[model samples]
Target: MPFINLKTLLRRESVGGALLVVAALVALIWANSPWAGGYEAFRSFTVILPVHAWAADGLLAIFFFVVGNELKQEFVRGELRHPRRAVLPIVASVCGAVVPALIFAVITFGHGDAAGGWGIPMATDIAFAVSVLAVVGRGLPPALRTFLLTLAIVDDLVAIMVIAVFYSAGLAWAPLLGAVAGLALFGWLQQGPMRRGPLRQGPLTRGPLRRGPLRRGPLRGLPQRQLPMKIVLVPLAVLVWTLMHESGIHATIAGVALGLLMRTSTLPGETISPSDRAEHLIRPWTTAVILPIFALTSAGVTVTGAGNLLASPAAIGILAGLIVGKIVGIFGGAWCTTRFTRAELHPDLTWPDIFGIAQLAGIGFTVSLLIAELSYPNDLGLLESAKAAVLLASGIAATLATVTLTLRAARHRRRAPDPAG
Candidate 1:
């Protein structure tokens, strides 16, 4: 429940972003090199699932789980606990998504089947955006970072909704029902009746058996000892995910569902809630292993025909949406919020700071690639073009953000009194 300051969070995300870039670069090199055929073979080779599917479905589920946990914690106990504090970023996030999709649609409408790829530009890669901010806007206020975090979190939640509702295959009723039941049970188990007795202190201590005044009904019969969370929770989570996967809804939805349903609070004696423990255990794995693996497999767009790829309608639409739409949508949304509501930008920040952050939000690397693959599943050329566009747009966005932020930082430094004074 301790507050992690913004700088610390940005530092952690920057590390992940660096790893992601490295992995993606390696993939691009390997895919375009003479070893391209071997890379394709390895990715297509199936165990229980194709290697690419494992990276996208299995590993990415862990990443989404962490995302869900963070969002839930924010809503339940962090900056988003208050509605007034949360509304600006939520509005900004919505506009950010809507404008990009609209731009993509308009740009690709006349092209064959390219309009379906509208969702590709709507996502903001939180890691990459935060990394850019950390590197170039170190002098910026922490509140700016918080705003970016909130915006990204809401953006991710919207992206998940789009994937679940738009991208999923036709539903299989039986497994769908099973997935629902499993999710409900998971929620119930985590919401186990609140402890009644004077809560025990410390992580390891067991609660007293005798009921106290604080003790309530229904939970009275339960033993004071903590439930075997691993034995009960893990299997149920797996069951839900499997059912969800078989139901033709992306399996990652199950991860988000379970994470949102998890308890953010535990009894006084408990060391950590399921949400905290799970995030702590898997965060490093997701950052260092899962995401890198995904990048290695998914970012390998063979750019043999670089000019053709860049000139493709899909690529043009994606680039336009990311580079132009994101900045307009995000900044416009924030400007409108300030104009119409009591919400305001941080005292230390200027319009230029918001613009820079908006530019960085265009770095829609991971989620954009996922949406691209889903959008053009049957068209290899289109998929490759879309992926290349994402890389290009992300790079351009990062560069613009870096320049703008550095100038802004330098301006602030100049206006400050010298330390020798």
Candidate 2:
């Protein structure tokens, strides 16, 4: 019954995803309509600020700040904290990333300029994937959710590196230095005197302490907690954004790095859970605002003719890389790791279940779109084509995975002899 409330919000994510799908369709139709010019204008239309730099830089910086918060939450307490528990998904994520990139690189071999798009297929859009899991009914387990979340976080880390290393334009050392400085500042905030000060005061305690030595009270050994470090780190992250933008690296990378560095774990003895604090602060803004806006802006596409779709190499490469690469990499990596390490699969799941989940991992819409934007900022035609292919591939992958998993689970239930008999 307690989860009934949680289920409502979860259901809304799925519903919101459906709306996004509709919006993408509308954008496509509008782009191909007589009002095509209007569609283009909508994308290019800027919200101007009195300060040009703020308009150009500030909005995206907020986007990255949200990203930083998510990354911190994951590393501090989410999935990445326990290395053994994390190994399966981490391995799968690496394989998922490396194999898709290699596949994309091989396909786009001659087009050196477009090869930077290799990262396009490396990410798993957690929102979309979670939505699919929700739709796949009761076949999936909580452990699978944990597994996928961890895998996606690692995938994002890899994707961020790919953007920083491969997609960045001519590097300006100054901005890179500034980004590094920002990260250092975040790290210091996590471990330095500031974090310790709150912990020293002990865990939050209500009411006044009793007088005398007893005044130390029931909370005498209460661990200290840090003030929300984001107060300081946020401004610094914005500065990093400016520098990264100036240096020609995509500013989002700064957000990802700052997130990873600043999300230090509170020790078991600590009063407050750092991961809880970070997630509580970050998840809503990122989910509700940053990601959706990014989707709306980047997912716009025009599929005017079949010829345009067929001719676009980036589109073909991305779709194939995601649909094919994710299934192969996830299933193969999971199988190999389990066999070699003899690790136990989740009790309720089997090989078929793992394979089905792997198939769902192909839903790469969000990260794929982001990469498409970075890869083809000047080539709207290529970007649109890629967007279309990503949507189509993701649809097929989700459908097939959902159907297969549902049937498999049903069969599993049916085959078990009734214990009552």
Candidate 3:
């Protein structure tokens, strides 16, 4: 397919963010309105599959797939390819996750049930953060965006590991093993073509896939060696996803596995990489549809009373962890990394810029809400409170970060030389 321009991609993401906010607002209003009973009934009335489950497990899988592809491309061909350059963001991301969790734990201490929501604050919603940065920090260095992207990617990697290791329930050994085998096969298929397919002898038999063939005029007689992606890769992806779901792990892991296993090279005739192709194909849907539906479903928090929301320890912990903890953790972690190691901040970024970006990272919306649900499955009250806190903290963080970044942007604009001069 055609490659999307970078500016266009960023613009789309900004629109996606706006849509997310609108969807969540609609949900919140519908849930809290006098017709709240109707909204509740609609959410509760399940058909073949619950709308809630479809949004969380099914739609979010596409989001994770896009995320996985991004991480793979970054490591293989983008910013995270170099260890020296990646070190600062990696360190900052780790500290960013750890501090929030620790703060949540400390605040919710002694409340055994509430403490489980620690992971709620550990995620940085990339869509919201990126949207805010792109809009308000237009005059900022591109490297700042790179830093935030890398940091958020690493933060997501940590969140995924936590979900896999901590949140999964009811271990089923047989399906787990099957998932492993399926993932292995998926990886092998990407590296080399299926033995029975036409691809068995052509591209894979020769060397790494190359761009030259596709760029050159189509050869009339060259045997098509690559298996049709729909016929082979799609089914394998479905099987792997099913196996993972049955294994009591989050099915989204399948998307991540498939994405990381994708091949980025072509054997002389290919112009697009499997990873990039998957991204281009899947990203538009995830951003525009899946995420908005998810926000609509998961963000419907009916505020019974101010006291109820304020009294919940889980909510308070999440609020503090996101607002206070993220700023301290990310900025402090960056500071410590620079102090101990030779790693330096981007040349164009000042301390205030880092502080603003750290605040932006705290605007955790979609993933945080998902984690809140998973954190407390039985307790509807706790779930609503946690959701409320996420919304509250995210709003505060967005406003504060926008103000901070806008000031910095204005300073840059004023200092810029006039063309007329």
Candidate 4:
């Protein structure tokens, strides 16, 4: 195969996903090697705060921020605009989350304190899933990818709610209120100084709305005065993150809150909305740096006893939840929704396609690792087993999905109609 250009490769979602994997592999190896002591020391070394916590609390928030923006756009002007197209993903996300938690609970039922990790496998890492799809999903129905994206976004919101309610420390009402106020201000600023032209008349309605989080030229359509507005937004955003952190909720929730409040529709002269620009500006950093750092710090598990970890309930629960539970949960949920409810799958797609996509949904790396940390804050041994289980399960999920989607793609191509007639 001919090599692609460096710039183009860097821009691909697969590249960032590859980096995250490589970082985790390096960390895992380092943690298990003879230099394990040094790895532990480095992970423990801090500058007035925990380095790993920064990756979890601060860096991951940037990823969630872009996700928040994507969710806003989809709900307002994208696939989520039509109620018919929206029903499947919404229902699937809820069922997908619930089933995994239930699986984890069943496995860890009698194990004291291990049940806290029931939330670890309840979420999907869309970044990894999308990359896997992009590489091997050629000739498949376009609806499959759309379904995955929509389902993941809604799934993220569900996961965020779980974290806020289950994982947070004692609530501090004053700071929580301050975070809410700051988010409101951020939303107000997103409105911009420009007024909306008549909705049904003119360029505002006719302009094509660009999608995706990491597109370049985000500032191309904005006015010069709007450039300086970042100064104010930056400080305000930090204030919100800080307040949310102090409020005993996860700080990443602040990013999601601010993202949801962004204005999705473009103003009179602008081609891009404030939400789009923010995503464009922040997505690259989140992908190239934040995710890799998070994987490095969180994925380092020193596997001293593989047999014991395999026997452990928390580990067994995570594996079962991601690999087995996700498949049964999401695919079963999709089937029941279309079968029982008025909702229908796209005419172009098949049940098998949904099954494959559900398999991909099990690659719950970044968020699962974070939840593992939160689930076993004081128990190093349990945390290690859980982290190992997550990595192993995600790899299995990715491999299975790849094989399933590749076969499906071949079948899709074979059935495609020719236009020569």
Best by lDDT: 4
Q: 1-421, model 4: which lDDT tens digit per residue?
A: 2333544455556577778778878888999899988888887888766888787778877777877777778778776667766798779878898999999999999899888899999989876687688778889977787788778867776886788788866589999999999988888877764232222233433334322122225444332222345778889999999899888777877877777788888765467777888876676666678778877887787665355566789989999999988888899988899888888887788999999999999988878877888999998878878887888888899999999999999999999997775
Model 3, position 404, has a per-residue lDDT of: 96
Query: Can you tell me which runs of candidate 1 are displaced by over 4 Å?
Result: 1-11, 130-146, 163-169, 193-223, 344-350, 377-380, 405-421
* Clash-forming residue pairs, model 1: 196-214, 196-215
Cα RMSDs, all models: 5.4, 6.2, 5.4, 7.4
Per-residue lDDT tens digits of candidate 2, residues 32-96? 78998876777777654222234223543454444455545655656545555557777888898
Give the C-alpha lDDT of model 3: 0.77
Who is ahead in lDDT, 1 or 2? 1
Which regions of candidate 3 fall more than 4 Å away from where they truly are?
1-11, 41-48, 111-113, 134-139, 163-168, 192-224, 370-383, 409-421
Give lDDT: candidate 3, residue 240. 83
Q: Can you give the lDDT of residue 309 in candidate 3? A: 61
Hey, what RMSD does candidate 4 come out at?
A: 7.4
Cα displacement (angstroms), candidate 4, residue 50, comes to 2.9
Flag clash pairs in model 2.
198-224, 198-225, 199-224, 199-225, 200-224, 202-222
In the range 1-421, model 1's lDDT, one tens digit per residue, is 2345432343365566677778878988999899999999988999999998888777777776777787788779876676765687778889999999999888788898777888999999876676567656656766577778778867877886787679867578999999999998888878654333334444444344332233455544333444466778789988998898888776877877787787899755566787888877777677667777887887777765356655787888889888999999999998999899988666667898889888988999878988888999998778878888888898899999889888988888787679999
Instruction: State each model's CA lDDT, in order.
Output: 0.78, 0.65, 0.77, 0.79
Each prediction's TM-score against the native? 0.80, 0.70, 0.81, 0.81
Shift in Å, residue 305, candidate 4? 4.6
Q: For model 4, what is the alpha-carbon lDDT of residue 294?
A: 79
